[model samples]
Target: MTQKNTEDPSSQKNDSDCGCGGETGCRIEAVLSVDERGQMVLPKDVREKAGIRTGDKLALISWEKNGSICCLALMKADNLSCMVKDILGPLLNEQDRS
Candidate 1:
């Protein structure tokens, strides 16, 4: 399944790609099933389009709402560091002044 983003954040896919585009600007890209071993394979076309290659690592992230896990997102392993910095950079800088 392919989805188009009728909004910003093109290709960056920075954990917030949302990929769901339509009247609501959000939709499911694919439905994956986990095996008994708890492993799911991403389709080849999606992987190729995302530049994900063999041996590439991914991070599974989840969002909590009302104290329950409500959403999930997958991110390239390498991008996690940059995301951490982007989130913590300001807080770290602020701490330096203390």
Candidate 2:
């Protein structure tokens, strides 16, 4: 049997607002189960809301705490690449001066 989460939604912080100082806060969008083929489907409404389409590529990112996996995140490949470049570009330039 599946157990339901009993946490209060209002007590949770919202991560959608990045400047809110809550980096780990997020709302549960949906609960999904993996199939025998190791595939899970994103809910229709969630997909639509996120503008995900059939041919879209996603980058799966896993977060580890204490050497164990704690969380998973997904972003479009294009966005992920842009984020990586934005974060690394300045650091790379600084290293070049050394």
Candidate 3:
């Protein structure tokens, strides 16, 4: 599935001329199955590269856009808030006015 954004950090290509010239920008497609207990196994390489651990905190986010549902995991607290604000800034301001 493809997603578009005006200017997205994750969407930036890993081209040789781009900021992330390494394979970090490469997207590895895989099928992840959620377990009966609502658990999914993140690939080992991905886990290591992301520095995710057994007890580390992760923010699970799901959203619908362009007629498709998308899910993502955020590892950092500040990043999670920034992402939420980016997606919900208008709504957040409206709520503040009440």
User: How does each model score on TM-score?
Assistant: 0.61, 0.66, 0.43
Which ranking of candidates, highest lDDT first?
2, 1, 3
CA deviation > 4 Å runs, candidate 2: 1-23, 93-98
lDDT per residue (tens digit) for residues 27-63 in model 2:
6789999999999999999999888999999999886
Colliding residue pairs in candidate 1: 20-25, 20-26, 20-27
lDDT of 2 at 66: 60
Model 2 residue 33 CA deviation in Å? 0.9
Which run of 10 residues does model 2 get worst, by summed lDDT? 15-24
lDDT of 1 by residue, 22-66 (tens): 555546768999999999988988898778999988998886655
Q: Which stretches of candidate 3 lie above 4 Å from their native place?
A: 1-26, 66-68, 81-98
Better of 1 and 3 by TM-score: 1
Higher lDDT: candidate 2 or 3?
2
- The lDDT leader among the candidates is 2
Best by TM-score: 2
Writing each residue's lDDT as its tens digit, candidate 3 over 37-76 gives 9987888987788877777777765555455654453455
